[model samples]
Target: MIRMYGIKNCDTIKKARKWLEQHQLNYQFIDYRQDGLTAEQLAVFSQQLGWQNLLNTRGTTYRALPAESRNNLTESLALDLMLQQPAMIKRPLLQRNDTFILGFSAETYQQLLED
Candidate 1:
């Protein structure tokens, strides 16, 4: 089963969902806010994608953090922050079996389909 993780209201998530539907690809959308995220899940994502890649530095959630919190962020701190606020994590994390594709791009999705 393919699972997509992100907030439902996010524009990127919306686009990704639309693309999936248009392509006739079936996927399960897991809204981080409504569905909730777990430490173990976050850990897995961190391990697979790297904490730096998973972290959304451009998002409001990360920007709203104190300068001290954002500066020189360590893996433990970043993981904790993401666990506390999932919006800090990157959007539309698509999972197919053991493979995880982060972010949304039509070309990437098409490649996913081919794979």
Candidate 2:
């Protein structure tokens, strides 16, 4: 089954969901805020996409962090922050079987469909 992970209210998540539905693709939306994410799950995503790709540096959650926490971030630090606030992780992390996709983009989605 395809599982999409992100906050329900996120615009990117909305777009991803809409695209999936419009394409008639079956997916399960997992809202980070309401559903909550486990450390193991975070680790799996981090491993699949790398902590850098998984981290959302442009988001408010990341910006609101202390300078010390944000500066010179390590994979360990990034994982900690993501565990504290899943929103700090990138949106619409699409997981299908062993494959993992980070963020949303129409062209990328199209490629995924093609694959």
Candidates in order have lDDT scores of 0.93, 0.90
**Per-residue lDDT of model 2, residues 10-37, tens digit only:** 9989999999999999988899899999
Which ranges in model 2 have alpha carbons more than 4 Å from their true place?
none
Best model number under lDDT? 1
Report the number of the highest-TM-score candidate: 1
Error of 2 at 85 (Å): 0.7
Angstrom error at residue 53, model 1: 0.4
Clashes of 1: 0
Worst 10 contiguous positions by lDDT, candidate 1: 106-115
Q: For candidate 2, what's the RMSD?
A: 1.1
lDDT for model 2, please.
0.90
Give the 10-residue window scoring lowest on summed lDDT in candidate 2.
106-115
> TM-score of every model?
0.97, 0.94
lDDT of 1 by residue, 40-107 (tens): 99999998999999999899999999998888799999999998999999998999988888999999
